[model samples]
Target: MARSTYVSEFHFSREVRRLSGESPAALRRRIMLERAAWRLQRGEAVATVAADEGWSSAEVFSRAFRRSFGIPPSRVGAEFRLPAPNGLHFHPPHSLWLDGNTASADIPALMIAHDIADTGYLIGRAAELSNTQWRQPLSPNQVVLDWDGPESSVAAVLCGTVWAKEVWLASIEGRDFPSRAATDPASVDARSLAVHHDDIGAHWSAMVATMTADGRLADTVIDALCDPPESFQLYGIVAHVLTYAAHRRELVRALLSRLDVPTRPGDPLDWMRGN
Candidate 1:
């Protein structure tokens, strides 16, 4: 890295400290430990994470973890984040995020959590059917969002559940609208459904976390692309999403049941208990 930047190693270290308030090695080490903590929180074996993070041994990793977090790795809980001066922290599913703000209070994550997971489950179940079964109109001539056209088939409803978030995320980021070319129910598969769900889920989690941390949900966003140029508060956007995402998820659950796919009731209690 130093050579690529045309600097000596010593000069590189100095510049890094000047810009980030930490040496390069320290930042890397801290980030590694953050990743280890996250993996542990997700139930990875201590020895496994230790090996992957370059710890000399599990004992050594535990010692370092306790030093950094003031708790033994065995008792690791909701927080995996460390005191990162640069606000850099490990984000799941292969990513890092910079979060300088701390929440005064948390926005409950449960509301949308079930919606996303249930949608993914429905998508997987839908994938088990033949194309004919998938495209068969479960609710012939039914409509969800008029702009989204018909979602009368199992495949269409399941795909719509995931696509809703992708489109909203685009709007939030002021990006061009996502293409509707993949709207064919028979063509959409479980893998694509899960990919879109998980990807948008990550972005959604990060956005909610940031807004909750900064208490910025009341902030307004104006849509320049709308012909009439609409405006929305951040919290209102979230509320709107939860409202419709819930609708689509319920549609998926009902449709999946109609096809005799065994699904737990759309109850959060059952979902939380892994029922």
Candidate 2:
């Protein structure tokens, strides 16, 4: 039974790699190394940290750490202790492991900027559609007046993306969101949508610049989603924004395809590779 389980796990890991373009083992190793670095920074002994990380021996662990981080495990405590302005901390190995020694601070801002630009690209595609094409139903069966109706759906999703980002920016600034009418997809037109897109892009770029300059990506913001509210990290919010924007962009692309409009490749992988 144990042998069967191991085989199943191995196959599952392979499938994950096929889909994500990254092996599960590699991701696990990354998390493990990050945790181990944090432990070492707390003054944990090398051998204990190695054993805790399931390394067969301290020597093996040290060698792996040095290879991954470009430095031996002993030096991690002193060299990689830079704390981001947002209260998040980074170990040197993280930057070395991920970016080959580039400053880690620019990573988040770069990711956010890319996502915003990608969304703008999608919106630009939408703007080129004829009025009839823009208003056409995404599907013959799509319900009239529903949010998914071609014209309304596209507007709502794009507006929601902007609104969500604005919410996070407001949270970061310790201010309430300015009053605006609730997003009405049915009423949104291409001209107004273009204006909203520009506004959001400018706001997002400024926010990224401010956060990067202030080093506040690791800072905590209060999330009122839970009972009595909960503390949410700033980086977590940015991650959520990136994910939501990506999903919405795909939906917009799908809608465009249904409308017989020309679509361009907008995959994140394509963006990462500078396509």
User: Highest lDDT: which candidate?
Assistant: 1
Cα lDDT for residue 103, candidate 1:
46
Give candidate 1's TM-score: 0.57
Candidate 2, 1-275: lDDT as tens digits: 32555667778778657764556676566557767878888788999999988999999999988877777888885444332222223344444333243565466666777778777787777777776666655544533224334334566666566667777777778787654453445566666766776786788778767875788878888778668998978778778888877777777788887777767777656777883
Segments of candidate 1 deviating more than 4 angstroms: 1-107, 181-186
- Clash count list over all predictions: 0, 7
Question: Largest TM-score belongs to which candidate?
Answer: 1
**Candidate 2, position 91, lDDT:** 40
- What digit string (tens of lDDT, one per residue) describes model 1 on residues 1-275? 99999999999999999888889998988888888889998999999999999999999999999999899888888888888778888888589998744542233577767767776677777778777777779898878888888889887876776677777777777788887545446676666666767877778868876876798888888887689999989888888878777787788778777888777677777887983
Local distance difference test, per candidate?
Answer: 0.79, 0.69
